[model samples]
Target: MTKQNTFLNDLRNEAITGVAYKNLMLKKQILEYFANISDATITDLSKGLNASIPKINELVVALIEDGLVKDSGKTEVGIGRRPSLYGLKSNSIFFVGVEVKKSHVNIGLSDFKKNLIKSVKRIPFQLTNSQASLDDLCIIIDDFIKSLALAENIAGIGVNLTGRINYKTGYSYSFFHFNEEPLSVIIKDKIGIRTYIENDSRAMAYGEFCSGIVDKEKNILFVNLDYGIGLGIMINGELYYGKSGFAGEFGHIQIFNNEIICHCGKKGCLETEASGSALLEAFKIRLQQGASSIITKDRPDFNDIQLEDIIQAANNDDTLAIELIAEIGEKLGRGIAALINLFNPELVILGGSLSATGDYLFLPVKSAINKYSLSLVNNDTELKMSKLGENAGIIGACLLVRERLLELK
Candidate 1:
């Protein structure tokens, strides 16, 4: 009754007595409000939540005692005295973000205010289709938690992974299929914290949305131009999950006529020609065809050239790199034009590694959208790059841990 018995005493006790159970639901609502709005006065909370002023004030006092809320400062009220403003305590609770890639993992910690407080990038680990790999992944997360050396107030963890994922059930139909338990449960069992799994692209898009940099648009299409193309859709400020949570496979859209097989076991997918891998492939093919690039050099050391090298070369004014990237952008834009016609989204955000090319990529995409989609539709969809860039996945994973744990995701 000294600590946690204050805010989240026991819901099971509600069956026999109504001491603390009922307040848990109300506290959750207030916590969610603070998570979104940052700070509020008691009077503002009363009016916004449509509750009595006394009740709101009591909860605010309780939250402060629980170390979750604090008096941020005072706000002017145009009268003699200023009103006190309450906000979330930045370090009261924490969320961890884990992004898994084929070659490495990205891990980070975020404070209650969604600011990334710590992170380790590109940790060397191979993601393979084996139980050892998944076990190693769990060990990696355990080690990260041990290294925190902070108070044990972690509320949740969010894992960002690729391929078909059921964010709702935490079951990944793709990787880690070797486990009988859902992927989230497996990680949670190891870390002893509630865990949530999400599609990597969707996590990135959500990061952009929560960053408050998308002009607060209600409708958005986030095109992830990573090693493989992906899409994340936000309709009416909510992440859209189709029947089975396989909603945003924008890369697999059949827009070309070729014999190339996609990772998803389909042919002529958009990603086969417009993703980071596609760009790399195009660069190599062009080099073999005698096209000039500073990175390619005399022998076209294909294995030596990385996607980053290509992007840097383009920024350095390498003609061949720019040409290949622009070509891929045009094709990608052609596919995106069809999306604009259908969704009529207010904004389209380009994210992931390949988006780093800046205008070398966006200009051609803009031109293609103008030419392909109807003027009314294309004009409505504004284009921009994600402010978070490569950090989006890690940031989004951390934010989503709070959101989904609070049932907001």
Candidate 2:
């Protein structure tokens, strides 16, 4: 290396914390190594980074002093002395991750180790409230922080919104708005905590990949079929956020020229036919047509029917409920077939509340995929349900905050 660069590196090494490193790139590289691997030793880090043992040791010492990495006792080898194992200091700092849905918002907290320090708190609220929605969100978050006394330790808040979000710019174009100011700044001002926002689908994909669920899979598509359909794309083991940070709007894909109007103001979108709300609407229509079912026995008014009611009834072998789920699954598979042809992902993971229906939904989905997808693309893709489920967004948001913190100088 050049003398000036080397001198700068040496000078910066001793003058910065993990959260704000002078040799930021090197420090971030070391932290990323520990973040990806569990219980690594200094020897492992040196080998992993392809650097000298002495240099790696020096950086490790700096990290240890900064309270970022900690010693985890020792690892034993065959007939040899134990080597000290190091890992992230999981509790050194904390983050709050919030998932905003149409009907409610869910918040959770995690530490550096990605451990869920607090159970998620769900608050019922309407997103259409706009500025009032931000008010309600701040109130809940403020109460949560005060209740746990975590105001001092938290580094920032991450919000996963189920709307069009420009993650790089920290703006939710479709959800939260504050006089055109960035949502992150508005949130920080109101909640008294630095905040970042991402699209929910991207967050879920990130959470699953980083949280060790699909850690081994390089290319995958995470399908979240909740109230609406959302896709999280992982390509070559990295989350692919398109130039606009809005690539995963799989729900808005126009599939047919039907009269059904989508919330996106388009007609015959995938979400209108295959989402949780879609399933509920179809079930309500069936009930209105006098199709006999236990749901109708309890909720004679179709407006009273919920998605959970259909899932429960389907599990109990209710014919109407099972049929509705199967229909939605078939429609969902058509949309997914297009994704398979486009991305050719190795794994397609189905998540969200509707996915819990299991075989009742997946069977039809697979059938449709087989009928629609090219054999070459279909043969290599393995479809499975998301292991992360509801916690995917929350976990993803917390990890994102840690990633952002590591980028500081």
> Which stretch of 10 consecutive residues in model 2 shows the poorest summed lDDT?
2-11
- lDDT by residue for model 1 (287-338), tens: 8788878885633677667777899899999999999999999999999999
**Per-prediction TM-score:** 0.88, 0.85
Write the residue-wise lDDT of candidate 2 on 66-139 in tens digits. 66678888787645788899887777668898888777777889887788888554578677747787788788
Kindly report which residue pairs in candidate 2 clash with one another: none
Return the TM-score for candidate 1, rounded to 2 decimals: 0.88
Q: Against the hidden true structure, what lDDT does model 1 obtain?
A: 0.84
Give the lDDT of residue 379 in candidate 2.
Answer: 97
